[model samples]
Target: MVSAVPECGGPGDLPAPRIVTDLAHGGRWTSLTAGGREWLWHRDEPRRAGVGPGDPFADAGGLEECVPTVRGTPDHGDAWSRPWRRAGEEESVDCPDFRLTRRVSAGAGRTVVDYRLTAAPGYRFLWAAHALLEVSGRARAVMTGG
Candidate 1:
């Protein structure tokens, strides 16, 4: 059975960007892919010590101020950052958390966005990469792991 994919998006701060931290996959970033190239949390590198699977991302950070942004460099940004650009005059959100505010540009035919997720009082969740790629169909045809 095919799931009802939300086409117009849900209740979120539209025209804005944010970090998407899901402890569901043990704090591992989930994904949203299209045209072979996809976007998700944690693309190799390293997972923050306490930011691994099952640990509530925001639950680790305190007072609603956790996570980080990755710009200037891949590791420079935080756990997750997704900017909600104007989607052709549409108002909808596909991301989870609505906290990311930084917007970086693309130079290598790829758009790199960085963001974060906070929990309680000093526990910050760390993430590495979530790239938006333009993979060819043939390449995507044999993809296996992340």
Candidate 2:
């Protein structure tokens, strides 16, 4: 089910952004709002209850963590289709060969996400932070730093 982390702004801290996470639905980040603007994209239609391996991607329009293989038989790897275990701010999902964990924290007018993958030695995999942003046609992406 979807869980929400309401807006937080401690007395001494900057205003924290608002976030919605769906732990039952692959731990997807369904909504993110900062500075009175929603940065993530949401689907116009309803979403399916549950998604499984080999099932059509819900494409509910949000942020998805694609683990191991993004173009394999399961489409977006095993994480996006399975439930995650949550402990405090951390959420994790287990694949056949590895375990992926993510910790999300927000404060000081910023949101931070940390990911960790544990697997046997020499195991190789690919990961993608599949984030869909709510942007207009004229919006242009700007990147800085290395």
Candidate 3:
């Protein structure tokens, strides 16, 4: 089963909100749940051991971060294929030219991830959140605050 926050909460034993991540393997979020419904797509098969620059696509699903050019020489950049250094709620990876960091926080019914990229002046890079969502046929989106 995907790793998640313990179902038991402080003192009351109430079901706690849950989110899952695999930090050693690309530092990607493997699952996200709210209202007892899963919101991310995941592969049913065993995930590969690791990915590397120029390696074939790791279609292992969930949310992955692509960095420093998504469709370039190294394929899906450098971050998604390597391990990250974790400090509290934040994790960071050092690329050849830049450092990418992400902080995740959860509150109420929402989970927030904040990203920061650092590099020398004049350095340029690209980043994207490659999140795959699980949507059922009857699912509908609610939009607010346009």
Candidate 4:
């Protein structure tokens, strides 16, 4: 499970479409089946401290430093290398100010993701959603929001 179209290839050149629901390697969300039950968390692993190989749609922080000369400007900003713009199931990544969109949909048991962030106003930024769900043996998680 690995749908590829993110761009600026590197992770083994990309494109591995078996097609159930796959988008691992940088824009990770590996698999999801819904009510029938097939939610196995993915891992090919390597790339530690900076985080796993499976990057469940990672986004570090935003608007970090760099305005003095402003060349590439990436310490932990710009949504991890930035190259996503697939329309249909929806996948977007842009950065002049901010525009990160991810949309995944499923039914039955539920696998719905609609993460969006569109900033470009006064530009005070701080975004966080580094998803890594690998629960096998003992699993218990309950999180609300603020």
Top lDDT prediction, candidate number: 2
Please provide, for model 1 over 24-115, each residue's C-alpha lDDT reduced to its tens digit, 9 standing for 90 to 100.
22222244433243433234423333342123332222112123433332233333222233222121222333333333332233334434
TM-score (C-alpha) between model 2 and the true structure: 0.85
Q: What lDDT tens digits, residue by residue, belong to model 3 across residues 17-92?
A: 5668777777677887766788899885344455655566587888888888788857777778777777766778
For all predicted structures, in order, the TM-scores are: 0.23, 0.85, 0.79, 0.25
Clashing residue pairs in candidate 3, if any?
A: none
Rank list by TM-score: 2, 3, 4, 1
Worst 10 residues of 3 by lDDT: 1-10
In model 1, which runs have C-alpha deviations exceeding 4 angstroms? 1-5, 8-29, 33-49, 52-74, 79-134, 137-146
**Model 1 clash tally?**
24
Best by TM-score: 2
lDDT of 3 at 31: 84
Clashes of each: 24, 0, 0, 0
What's the CA error at residue 12 for candidate 3, in Å?
A: 16
**Residue 133, candidate 1: how far off, in angstroms?**
2.5
Greater-TM-score candidate between 1 and 4: 4
Model 4: per-residue lDDT, tens digit, 1-146?
A: 24422212224544222213232222434443332343444544444124431233233221111211122334434555434456777776666677777775543323445777777667666554433343567777689996
lDDT of every predicted structure (CA atoms): 0.31, 0.81, 0.73, 0.43
Q: Please give the TM-score that candidate 4 achieves against the real structure.
A: 0.25
Query: Which residue pairs in model 2 clash with each other?
Result: none
